[model samples]
Target: MNAAVLRQIDPGMPAHPNELDRKRIERALGSRQRYRYVSPKVSCVTGGYHIESPCCSRNIDADGGVIDVALLHHDAASATWQVFRKDHRTGAWELHGVHQRLGSVTDVLNADPERVFWQ
Candidate 1:
């Protein structure tokens, strides 16, 4: 995990939406609740990886309504990462955002709509 994106426990109100999203994502990532659902699958491509969690699609839980979320491979050389969501209507993986560190990836995960899947 890159130090720049590492999340710090503030124990106070988040300064912004991204902060809140990051915290929630960290919680979700550590949660065993996700294990109750199906494990997300991953695929390796020439340049990166693809991760998909089907249980998260259209599922409801304490966090929020689940939607289709994925992690698309970004730059292999730099080890950069990007998040994507499958458009329910168009069936395309739309870009959610990018992460430079491990903690930021949690923020990306938190940004995902609530569903039952675990990644």
Candidate 2:
């Protein structure tokens, strides 16, 4: 994915996806961490290590690009997604176990596919 597109999609670097209804876990003295991801398949993606730890940290490009979904994983202990930060600092998201793939999304079946099929 293009870096420019990534910047445009995640202008604020929000911890979770705007559409995710989940209320991520929170820890004391820290802001709550949340996870958001796009699920076209509507079920748990359980086959690839890359899915478990996406280096670019999934991002979407509603405007037009190579991505169309983004997810945020929260670290309950630190109360923030260490993965996104780690990717920013190093200019790359590592393949460590910390970049674990998130669970399945329950609201996907009910999602509004307005722009999805139009493309």
Candidate 3:
């Protein structure tokens, strides 16, 4: 994972991502050590509002810390599908600038055919 590529993949530092965008993250990680990752439904402050969409969250141990990857689709604010990953270094589930779409995710994974698998 090149730092440059990571930056390019996630240009905008969006604080909160939609539910749909969080679902498609697994497709990018491919085969990694499976860990319990629950993609909790987004709860809005507005009592009467609900965002119902297919979203997901997956976790992988990168550099001895848990990294979360979430994907969503067709969010109201961000029309285009978005993806993001949370770094476990800050001691909080803060979404870092690792945004990438399903296509880009797949492309990034495919780009490294000989990636060393730790399994």
Candidate 4:
């Protein structure tokens, strides 16, 4: 295969979050007060984390599967965290906020002032 073809086929792996940052992110999400009752689950992804909670609304899904809550990615180059909210209808991740510290991102998720992430 040509170089271009190889590049297209394998775009290369995403930058992995360092252990310290990863642990901090996980702790922030796991200890969210709003989700304490729900017991949110946090999974490490290529460059960030995926958070989900058990579905409670039958109208949304009859199976009661977990629902996407939020996504947080670390941008090593920028030294910042990017927060995203899932659009349930379109299944697309929309950028919500960005912060330099994990605690700031946690505050946004906890407050959810606009009902974006928690909703």
Output the number of the TM-score-best candidate: 4
lDDT score of model 4?
0.74
> What lDDT would each prediction earn against the true structure?
0.48, 0.28, 0.33, 0.74
Candidate 2 TM-score to native: 0.19
Pairs of residues at least 3 apart in sequence or in different chains that clash in candidate 1: 56-117, 65-114, 66-114, 66-115
Can you rank all candidates by lDDT, best first? 4, 1, 3, 2
lDDT of 3: 0.33
Deviating ranges (above 4 Å) for candidate 1? 1-36, 56-68, 76-79, 110-119
Model 4 lDDT, residue 105, Cα: 87
Better of 1 and 3 by lDDT: 1
Candidate order, TM-score descending: 4, 1, 3, 2
Candidate 1 on 4-105: residue-level lDDT in tens?
A: 344354434222224333344434555434444554444444434444554443332335444444544555356666666666556677776677765666
Q: What does candidate 2's lDDT look like per residue over 1-119, in tens digits?
A: 54346648977553333223232111110221222232232112121111122123334333333332222354534544322212332345442224333332212212314322112
Candidate 3 per-residue lDDT over residues 1-119, each given as its tens digit = 64345547886633233333334433434433332243223332221111221223212343333232332233336433332333334533332223234456435433434331111
Report how far off residue 80 is in candidate 2 (Å): 2.6
Kindly report which residue stretches of model 3 are placed more than 4 angstroms away from their true locations once superposed: 1-67, 70-74, 91-101, 109-119
lDDT tens digits, residues 1-119, model 4? 54345547866734444455556666676655454556676778878888888766533456777889888898978979899999988999999988998789888888776767765
Best by lDDT: 4
Q: What lDDT would candidate 1 get against the real structure?
A: 0.48
- Model 4 residue 100 distance off true place after TM-score fit, in angstroms: 0.8
Give the TM-score of each candidate. 0.47, 0.19, 0.28, 0.72
